[model samples]
Target: MAKTTTASKEGMAIRTKREIIKLLKQEGALDALQLAKLLGLTGMAVRQHLYNLQEERLVAFEEEARPMGRPAKMWRLTPEANRLFPDGHADLLVSMIESMREAFEEEGLEKMLEIRNRKQIIQYLSKAPSDLPLKEQLEALAHARTAEGYMAEVIDNVDGSYSFVEKHCPICEAAKVCSGLCSKELEMIQQVLGEDVDVERKSHMLTNSNRCVYSIKPKGSAVL
Candidate 1:
């Protein structure tokens, strides 16, 4: 039937998109021509699929300049695309948390969180320059957080403050069960940034938002 044919075509498109995502994840970035050659499809077909994926915000492209000729556009998976990949670590984290809770109870969980916070502070402090201005310190903190899979960014406010936005949380699965982990993270951020700045959670992923946002302001200053 005509309807059945249309449905089949749609299903094929979905399968093709999944294949493209998988390829990007495994091989990093590739051009449409490269992807077409690998999939045995025409360049036009691969490009069409890439277009759809881009509209969905799962894929992105960067222009890479070569020694000669026009720059080649390389396609890559965006942070949103990361959710499609299997999180093997999530299962391991949950298992570890359960074991700790069973062996040491609530106090054990608290201790684990405390140790994590202390270690995180030390790690971040080692990378964050103490002599930089407040804004630069926030930028350094954002870079460190991004390296740790938080996908964090620093946004400057007009009033001389910053907004720390984390578009992705790698430990969401663990945080669902152990929310104290999130609390410790906030405490660590405040402690590491110094005593003159205040950090407040403006938005949270646990409340169903897609990202977490922290409003950073100077102490004794008006809220941003």
Candidate 2:
């Protein structure tokens, strides 16, 4: 007979919590029942973990209306939980931007933004080629963005259009100080997708939306 060892309670709890966070990041707000179904755990068990996370201010819940009854509690990661994900040295990046602004003013800052965009365009183009189908290009671009801590994904509209969503922005703090950083990202995407493709910023986190959503479709068609 083979003997099997079970994970320690503490270790299991930690891993489960991380999984919960990962699911929420990928799928957005979900109720305990949804989470339980996804994680294959009892709803009670998931609720316990969620309550614990709520106490830590890592997660929060809002009442979401359902057609049948009272609103269900939909849970999501709090902004504080952003620290648990890769941040790409947010503080240092913000500091560098501030220092550059002090030394060079708006003109110098704009120049730096251009330089950074050129480099990012090169890197992004290598991953996502315009020749590929639009869906394939988005997947490649999302992969590259996720690798850089953007937590990006592509959403199929099923009507010959797609949505490029970035759930979290690792350099959000830096972007806040330098709006050009935000605009240049769109430029990079435009350059990668080529002129026939239309990439529009539908929603932005800086505008108080939960995430950044870009409407992408071929030119000469409505953005359904």
Candidate 3:
């Protein structure tokens, strides 16, 4: 049986890491093979992820005795990780709208007056050129998204799939419904490509103590 845990939304820079924490929080502990099989990732990939998580101080492991080999490392989510994600509420756009409403309430018509300026602020600050490689562009966009409070993380699956993990949903958390943050995320994704890129949304947090595996298969290449 696999142990599970719920990952909090704090300190979890990526959605994948958050989902992994959630799994570890709920399930308790999982071996590498179990993590690989459950999350649909290769063992080596899983190990790399585990190492990263460990470095973040989000996960710990014990050397468990095996039947015929040396003791193997079994990973577990720490309490700190559980505390980070809090509840799995993804109120993305709703939160954004609520924030806008609050600002409007305080600023009144001034809010409307400031909207274009705010837009200009972001447009001026965003220096992501369109000439970079798709991967590089994605990384730049991911950085921007993270700065804007999306908890975005970019993963190069090494298979050609670029996994963008959304860690926070201010709208979802605030409005509870009537928000299509996921759609907006997809739209941003489309802007980075000339042709139709195979952007897939796993609809899972990448942080919670559990593995949320995804691949980026290159164009005309076999999917991993």
Candidate 4:
């Protein structure tokens, strides 16, 4: 077995911090209390770390104006802090992917590659029992992927069509590449559908970037 290098660990740590940084970027600002709650840590603990972050100019806090009460400070990323984070999927997706990566004790690179492997998807969904209807089967597939840290959602596109969207891609932003996550998603979808399905992606606005949406035409639905 090869010994893991220090750089690998550091990379994961940065990825983890970047994960937090991603959230800050999304919310645009958060007070120490909010950060503590979001991270499930005590306010003091978050404050301690943030103190150093402030020194490094990665974060800054300012007292907010309040009526009839002491002003509270809100924490937010500085311009420097923004530079430290990778521009990846929306913060939710980044956090989810990072959480899953840590939970599996796997390197982010390896985890992403494994998830993208076409065969793995086919094998997993193949385990679903055929007795379930297509919608139920699709939900099962989405839920399974969600368990793996992907924010997967299936939306009814109406007229008997379904839209499949993967709202996060951890590897995409890290590597500045697509990593074919969408392709793998489509593959699993086809396996579940058991036939050619009309699928297309829609134009999306921010607040949820890097999301993949596929419009599906389920079998035997007359509406186009």
Q: Candidate 3 on 59-93: residue-level lDDT in tens?
A: 89999999999988889876456447533354454
What's model 1's TM-score? 0.65
Q: What number of clashing residue pairs does each candidate have, in the order they appear?
A: 0, 0, 67, 0
Q: Judged by lDDT against the true structure, how good is candidate 1?
A: 0.85
* Candidate 2 residue 44 C-alpha distance from true site, Å: 0.7
Sort by lDDT, top down from the best: 2, 1, 4, 3
Model 4, 119-181: lDDT tens digits are: 665665665444577667667767776666555667775587777666543344433333345
lDDT of candidates 1 onward, in order: 0.85, 0.89, 0.57, 0.60
Question: By summed lDDT, which 10 consecutive residues of candidate 3 come out lowest?
Answer: 206-215
**Residue 122 in model 1: shift from native, Å?**
0.7
Better of 1 and 2 by lDDT: 2
- Displacement of residue 25 (Cα, Å) in model 2 is 1.1
lDDT accuracy of residue 39 in candidate 3? 76
Tell me, what's the RMSD of every candidate?
11.3, 3.0, 12.2, 13.0
Model 4 lDDT at residue 166: 60
Candidate 4 backbone collisions, by pair:
none
For the record, the alpha-carbon RMSD of candidate 2 to the native fold, in angstroms, is 3.0
Query: Could you tell me the lDDT of residue 87 within candidate 1?
Result: 43
Off by over 4 Å in 2: 1-7, 222-224
**TM-score (all chains, Cα) for each model:** 0.65, 0.92, 0.43, 0.43
Q: How many clashing residue pairs, candidate 2?
A: 0
